[model samples]
Target: MEAKFQIFLILLAVLAGTALLARRINVAPAILLMLAGIALAFVPGMPTVELPPELVLLVVLPPLIYSASVAMSWREFKSNLRPIILLALGCVIFTAFAVAAATHYLIGLPWAVGFLLGAIVAPPDVVAPLAIARKLGMPRRILVVLEGEGLANDATALILYRFTAAAITTGLFSLPKATGTFAVIVVCEIVFGVAVGWLSLRARHHARDPQVEITLSLITPYLAFWIPEHFGGSGVIATVACGLYISWNGPLLISSATRLQGIFFWDLIIFLVEGLLFLLTGFQMRLLFEKSKAFPLEDILIATALVAIIVVVARFAWVYPATYLPRLISKRIRERDPAPNWRTVFVISFTGVRGAVSLAAALALPLALPSGEAFPHRDMILFVAFGVIFITLVGMGSGLPLVARWLDITRDGRDEHRAEHEAEIAARREVLAAALQSLDAITDDRRLSDEVVKLLRARHESRTNQLPDSLDPDAYDVSAAGTALTRELIAAERKFIHVLLRDGKITDETRRRIERDLDLEEASLSNREFRKIAL
Candidate 1:
């Protein structure tokens, strides 16, 4: 067995355990994985483990992003398309330039490498925002916007990174060519994504078996990702497109069982990918440093701080202006409601937590350029990007609640949710009442067994307390529904027992024993009741 594979297995277990623990504790797992990796690297008898840079993004991202896309609701993403695009594409470009400019002068790095660093760290982590938004129980609108942004931003950032890397390697930067390349990449990515998505939907339309359908859905993301990359398009975009397309079309084509099974299977795959990716980031950072020894530690530290500030500040610049621009344009053009509110802007801005992609891109930088010389500023770029991710994610992430409180967003949101929750409960209670009384009837047996009548009366009295006045008379009266539903249950049970007996699945002795058991309490059952009463 290879040492790296052994390390990989151990890290997998460690990350999975840490992730579960973090979920239980209601905190982000990114911090836990990073700490664990660093600890493992330092521990005795733990071989210094480093993941292959080429494998980090290639092996992990397609599944992670695809799983996230699967989990997102299509309706939510569709409704907030504008804001998501602005942040994912527009804000990404803005941030890239801001960071590039800041790093260019501050770090004394060449123009291309600095911009490459910017591009590398441009997109905030999809895993981070998606996890936090879900955990915080943010509104669907907010979550969808974040999710959509995360999904799209990576494509933009990766394209920029490619061009930036090319310029640095070749020492020839053409504005016209880069612009054309950017446009072409974006268009091709979208086209590929749509095509793949359409294919997924087509596959599901023809699939009949739940097992086969789910297996096909599991395969869709990788196919979408690899195909686009193969064709010089954005794999990330292709994966997202396919995931979104399949999910949207699933209700139309896929069976209920297939959707349910796919959710669980894909969720597990995502958990594994995300957990392993973060852990790998920490270890890989050390490898980049070890290989790029010419870069001084102080230089790396300073560059990191500079890039982190740029990333953080760039968000503020992009968010505030972009948030309001839609509203202004809407007054004349589309004439729609403006973008998010001021508080939402704050929430959105602070939610920019960098994660795996930035680290992966940094690690993916060529060890030596086409010139056969060590990649200039490669160590610094990786170190700074990692630092940006760590500080922004841990620093702002830990303080998110505080920021919300400071803006008075948390308290107001809590109160609103509380009221909304109470209303939902009230509504649900009404529904239950209606569902119950749906089975209500006027009893014809005036001389019904005294004990049975007395039990029925008591149950009816209990129903008044449980069922609110708003409920119609035919509402969720348990006793009434039970009276109607219990007979079906009895018939099913009789059939089951009869089937067993006829098939010799049960013996006469066993039947008698069961009959004796069931004869004692005659069950009180309902339409949905699936179990049987034993004698």
Candidate 2:
């Protein structure tokens, strides 16, 4: 127990330190975490950390999937739904088959087992590379397509994996049966998830305290996963559906306070989980090689290289047609969306980084079959999956900025902000119009103060007149000034409270009460800053 505790502490410390260093140097933090883990493996007397396969699939995946879904833009996701489906489902299936053929021909694995290996590495993990892409200021449209693909591909790949494994174990392969089960799993999981999300939101409508609402938000995803999986449905699909449903309704149902708090909470959770996953990948890689030495080192390296190359090439093969074919076939699509240039498609094709999901699936493979025979090349599959993750995540993540520069893909920042400001200006005008009409209706009431009504109307009119026809940085500059003023005021209040305590001018209880109010004021200002930055 003591050793286990020590190991946990060591892992956490390394993860935290490496993550900070990565941020300082402006590289993907996951890359540094993996490197640190690899270095630690060579250190003398470092304790081994083992992650159970079930723990990852059951515990780690739900919140990551749910949090992402909650934050995703459903409108944008729907708009690009066709391309997303093509990449997420079609590309994943194609890649799996392509990898399977390579593995069977070159590595001499059976068809079912070869395909199982393919499914393990099929869905590209977007968590690491997506972060890097966002930092590089990639276009929003491309980011949406990439993020949407990551979310949907996992469910697709896992379903294929399960079917392939079943065939290997039982020697029964039926395309129709697999298709039927796949449909049932998706439909049932979505239905179950939607029902859970609706109930959770209804409960949230009555809750007043931010703490209570936050707790409910945390449990909602778990229940979403557990309920569906318990009834023979895909937990991943259920969790994602529940998250999307809640995300769509949360802005309306939740208070501003809850939204701010929940955002911070989930951000922290994802950071820690993602860091640990990369570290675990590094640790598992070292352990797998040591535990199983069945194949020659040269043979293992060759197989790993072959599999990694296949994964990258297969994506390129799929993405080009996926980008252009729809527009060619459907005039409606061509008329609605702009045609994507080859440069954009190239970036998308190259940035498919395999992440923790692939590692988890490989690790989760069963050790023995129904006939008590060992699963073929289980250890080799894990090693190959690790190689793919390492190659794609580190290679692509590091080189993406250079590629973007070479492609010369720059964002139209001015136009984007101009459009945003126009929308905001329009919304404010509508609200003021409504307020003026309401004030006119109540102007004759005896209970109302004429002076107060006049003051309110004048303020609204002044604000409306200040609105610009286009984006003006000066209009939003006031927020930064206000933020600075709030910070100075908070500092003064803290000092005054300390002085009061030192001089015994106020009771401890009184000081505490006053400090709490100051804290709330700071939180409100912080929330405003957060919203501004988001815009």
Best by lDDT: 2
In TM-score terms, which candidate is top? 2
lDDT of each: 0.73, 0.83
What TM-score does model 2 achieve against the real structure? 0.89
lDDT for 275 in candidate 1 is 79
**What's the TM-score of every candidate structure?**
0.77, 0.89
- Tens digit of per-residue lDDT, candidate 2, span 403-500: 88788654432345446556766887889899898888878655678788889899879756645433445555665666778789898999999899
TM-score of 1: 0.77
How many steric clashes between backbone atoms does each model show? 12, 0
- The local lDDT score (0 to 100) that residue 91 gets in candidate 2 is 96
